[model samples]
Target: MRIGLYPGTFDPVTHGHLDIIRRSCALVDRLVIGVAINRSKGPMFSLEERVAMLEPICAQMSQDTGCQVIVHPFENLLIQCAADVGASIIVRGLRAVADFEYEYQMVGMNRALDDSIETVFLMAEARHQAIASKLVKEIARLGGDVSKFVTPEIEAKLKDKLASS
Candidate 1:
């Protein structure tokens, strides 16, 4: 089976992330959405909380697309995580040329590490091109409405998190 790996910090999965997930699902038999344990940037949500938040959303996506979407957590290198899950392709979303340049370097490094695995870059839809998790969190921290940038569920969670913080 063609398993694709979509790894991200997913501090809070935004609509742009979901867009890539949906599109990636169409290209693979199964898509593993790996939530990286990134403590350096200090994520708003815990790894478990992030997985909990993604569980239902991935289930819904799986049901909607007739493909399996597995949410997994990884603390190791992305290539190692992909190998652990038997992923032949790594799906990444590019929002702009800047994203491409960054991803290109990473893709080359990943290829050098494991030539068996290939990276696929998907362009973010125009509407979601500007929707990044960091910016979304910043906007929410500043009391800005992010309903247009995320699902209602995610928007509610962001609001709840901001309110308590």
Candidate 2:
């Protein structure tokens, strides 16, 4: 019954995100990929599109890793989602000191909000340390190929989105 929450905007679920999802799969019985509605950033895709993108990715992850991965969109404080799911852990992927600095503070805040919940930090694979959704969107917007960053499915969605936008 050990469940964990992985909350993020997931603007476009990249391989970097998948890497963390893959690694965390081994340690928990279930992992909820929380597609948070982040009002702070302009999203390239809509919430529905993001959820659509995550559905297949999560299904594939479960099939490949034998770990149950489900995607949920939460508009409230992240701790509420964790509480609703009865998850006592928050899984975060740390890529560098800069990443750690922000995540550390957020982790502390989440812990303070819910003392029963603990945040688990997972280091991103060395190669993916610099790859982020912002970077991917920037590359695509500037007509640079980002095939290696996101899945083929995500790439197509991005292409279609960019083409129309």
Candidate 3:
């Protein structure tokens, strides 16, 4: 089976991420959403919380797309995480030229480490191109509406999280 790994912090999965996830199903039989445990970033959500949020959504996507979707949390190198999941392709979502500049360097480094695994970039839909988890969190924290960037379920979770924090 062709398995692909899409790695990200996913502090709060945004619509932009769902767009990429939905599109990625077409390229691989199994799509592994790698939730990175990057402590350096100080994510708004805990690793477990992030995984919890993605599990249900991924399950629904799998049912809708007929592609197996699973969530895997990783604290190691992204390339290594891909290998662990038996992924030959690493899927990435590109929003703009700025994202490409960083991703380009990452691709080069990943290739240097493991030339066998290839990286695939999917451009976010125009409407979702501007939606980012960071921005979503910022807007939510400031008491702004984030319904446009996240699902209603996620919006509720964000509100609850912010209210408690």
Candidate 4:
């Protein structure tokens, strides 16, 4: 089986992400959506909460797409996580020129870590190209409607976090 790893901060998975996940599923036998740990941006939800939020969304997609999906809160090195999971390829969603610049370097670094590992970049569907988890959270935090950008569960989680703060 061709295992593919899709790693991201996922503070809360957005529709744009789901879109890529949906498409990527068709290209690979199995896709592992790794919730990568990043201390710099500081996630809105705890790691546990982050994993929980991914469950339903992932399940729904897997059921509909016939793709096996796993969501894991990966706390160590991204390349290590992929290797541990036996993923031969890393699936990434590229939205714009800005994203390309960042991912280009990341792909190179990942290749250095494991030359056998390859990175596949998929362009976001047009409507979702501008949507990002940070952008969704920012709008949701400011009381802007993000119902369109994220799943219902993520929306509720974001709303709850914003309310508590």
The C-alpha TM-scores of every prediction are 0.98, 0.97, 0.99, 0.96
Clashing pairs in 4: none
Which regions of candidate 1 deviate over 4 angstroms?
A: none
Q: Which scores greater on lDDT, model 1 or model 3? A: 3
Write model 4 residue lDDT over 139-159, tens digit each, in one string. Answer: 997899998998777788898
Over 77-137, each residue of candidate 3 has an lDDT whose tens digit, in order, gives 9999999999999999999999999999999999999999999999999999999899999
Ordering by lDDT: 3, 1, 2, 4
Per-model lDDT: 0.93, 0.91, 0.97, 0.89
Model 1, TM vs. native: 0.98
How displaced is residue 117 in candidate 4, in Å? Answer: 0.6
Off by over 4 Å in 2: none
Candidate 2 lDDT over residue span 75-145, tens digit each: 99899999988788899999889999999889888888888998999999998888899999999999999
lDDT of 4: 0.89
Error of 2 at 156 (Å): 0.9
Which one is best on TM-score?
Answer: 3
